[model samples]
Target: MTDIRHRYRKLVYLTWFLTLDLIMFGAFVRLTDSGLGCPDWPGCYGKLTPLGAGAHIEQAYQAMPYGPVSWGKAWIEMIHRYVGAALGMLIIAIVWMAWRHRHALGHSARLALFTLLAVCVQGAFGAWTVTHKLMPLIVTTHLLGGMSVLALMTWLAARENPGPPVLLSTRRWRPWLIGAFLLLTIQIGLGGWVSTNYAALACMDFPQCHGQWIPDMDLHGGFSLFRALGELPSGEMISQAALTAIHWVHRNMAFLVFLILGSVAWKLRADPVLRRPATGVLLLLLAQLVTGLTTIFFQWPLLIAVLHNGGAAGLVLCCVTLLVRLSRKSTVPQGIQYDKHRHPGSRLAPAPISGTD
Candidate 1:
């Protein structure tokens, strides 16, 4: 039994590490613009690695060497794919462990199985993302899917080795924190959509767009949410206004999200047990704000851009984990008590038999 417990703990840690790696690689894929480097699904130009199909790529490049299918892009795409495959393997391993020790690990087995299924769906979306030529909706979904996997893994990690549970006299704030977390996640998804669609700089100003606080936005064109990426309903190229609209909505939503999360942090800070995480959330939010501004002022420096995305992910994970901890029921026995009063005819209660007698 001890050995099983040890093994379970190791699996949980390993799963979390792999999930982190998956997120990093996903970031790299986005940052490098190698998302469509291969222009194919599951393989690079129909081969496992770019080098494996060098001759083919060379022929295509020879025809148009300056095109998007360059050697560097293909390598980046292939590397991302490899990392994703490795992560998939790790998820499978986690599922296997959970099934093997279902009883000991509580609901971990069920959760692991669900994670495994989610990753499979995410992988399919990833393939479609490339095959569809970096469709914005698909890409955004892919990003969210990866983050969801991370969230699940973090939740599992928290559950497996939760420290001493916190005892809160009031439960009202707990639901608010959960709501705040959900809102932040939705905001993050919108942000991902903006980034994936290359709409970050559509609104260059901090609190406004194109000299107007709310520049004339074409919601119909901008959010043509159902159209194929890069194309409008009429088969025309998507308008710049649409891209600007996407960026604008994301920018505006950030303010609201920040306000809500900031309030949550303030509320959480009142609890001693939650102070550290609350502070951490506050610090990360500040970092996110600064990096976001820097990206605008400095023309989106690669390092800052990556850091901003990573910070957002980190913030969500931290808040969610803290909320999980705060919600856990105390495990301490509540029936045990020491009584000082004694009954007149009994010894268990100390001097408390006057009324009874």
Candidate 2:
């Protein structure tokens, strides 16, 4: 049992680190605008890395020095791809480990398998995201998929560690907390879409859009969510209004999500087990808000932008972990046993009427 526990813990730590690496690679992909730099799935210009296709990359860069196929862009895209592959390999290993030690880890084998399947689908969407020229919908799904992978790995890690079961008093809030976490996940997805579409500065002001509370929003054209990769349904290029709409929705949703999560945090503060995570959520929320505002006010500093995304991901993980912990029934202490004498309820006939009795 001890050996199994140690192995599970090690796997959990490894998955956690790999998940973080995946997140960093994701950031790099977005920052360099290399979502389509490779223009191929599982390879860069038909090779595994940029170095493998040095001649092609050189020609492309020489053809257009400022184009998306530049050396830096290729490297960024290639690195992201490599990291993604590494994550995939790690997930495969996790699944294998779970299967090999199914009895020791109890229910984690199934969860590990699910994660493996999820990452496979995520990889598909990633390919589609690039192949389709970063279609807004596909891109958004791809971003959320990465986050889901992170959340799943985090959940797996927690299950392996299995912290002290939450008290019954706290368990009652678990469902609501889970709901809040899901809502935040969706909001984060929208934020990702906004960022991927380069719509972060669409509004350029808080509490208003272009000096007006609502500015003239072309919702019909702007939010034609079923449009093509880069072209609108009307066969026209996607307009700034569409970008503004995406940005506006994400920005406005941030405020509502903040209120909801803040309320949850406040409610959970009394429980010591929950207090630490509650405080963490609050701190990350504040940091996200600041980075978000600073991005707009400072013309979208790269570092702040990346940090905002990372903070959002971290917040989601923390919320999900807290929810999972709070959902379990608290365990009784070792010394506690069924004894009618201790309770003195009188109505209860506890335990067996022993032969000695």
Candidate 3:
């Protein structure tokens, strides 16, 4: 049982890291405008790899030089697909091992199975992203789906190694903790919308957009979800005002996120079991602020934009870890003896949770 547990832990850890990488790579594909490089599903130009599709790629390039379909971009998009495919296979193995060891693994097996389901759905979104011609709604949903996979993997990995249980007293913090998580999720969705619509640069100036605290905006058009990439449902091209609305909403929401997460971090810092993730949330919040402002000041440099995306993922991971830790039930037997000199302020065990970070 110990050996099986160790092996499963190693596998879960690997999958978690790979999922994180895939999220960042997915960002890279979107940021580089390579989402449509292949212009097909699963395979590049209807072939398994870009190598065999070279002629088609060349033809497309010749048709429109500096277009989305080029040798470099096809490779980037194909590599993203290949990595996603490999991650899916790894997830399958995880489900298999989890089911095989379900008796000892307990709830983690189910979590692993659910992770498999999520990856499959994410794969569907990936296909629709291309087939739908990169529609803003579909692409944003795909982005959220990728983050969902990362969060689930983080939770599953956290369960692999049990830690000193969180105290019952910490239950009072649940509302605030969960609220912080919800706020972050919504902010991420808005950020996705901004990216999908190329609205990051809609308001090139920070704190004030277009030299106004509240610029002219089309709230209804900006948030209409049933339109094409840059068109309204009426088949009219979207205006700059609509894009400005998207960016403005996302920016204003950032201030709220900062407030809620800052408060949550302060609350969690008082708990020894949750301090690590608290610090993580604080640091990531600051990083998001920095990268977000620099993205505007510097005109959205590739590295800064990608890092901003990554910081969001990191925040999701931290939030999940905190939730998992807080959900643990204390297993200390009644009347258990404690060595006060060696283990201070601990009623159950001396060590804190292992995966809080």
RMSD of each: 7.1, 6.4, 4.4
- Residue-level lDDT of model 3, residues 122-209, one tens digit each, is 9999999999999999999999999999999999988875656654566578778899899999999999999999999999987899
In TM-score terms, candidate 1 sits at 0.88
Q: List clash counts for every candidate, in order.
A: 6, 0, 0
Residue 307 Cα positional deviation in candidate 3, in Å, after optimal superposition? 0.4
Question: How high is each candidate's TM-score?
Answer: 0.88, 0.89, 0.93
lDDT of model number 3: 0.90
lDDT of 2 at 288: 91
Q: What is the lDDT of residue 328 in candidate 2?
A: 58
lDDT at 73, model 1: 80
Could you tell me which residue pairs clash in candidate 1? 222-242, 341-349, 341-350, 342-349, 342-350, 342-351
lDDT of 1: 0.78
Provide the global lDDT of candidate 2 against the true structure.
0.78
* Residue-wise C-alpha lDDT for candidate 1, range 133-173, written one tens digit per residue: 78778888898898888888888887876655443442457
* Candidate 2: residue pairs that collide: none
Error of 3 at 137 (Å): 0.6
Better of 1 and 3 by TM-score: 3
User: Between candidates 2 and 3, which one is better according to lDDT?
Assistant: 3
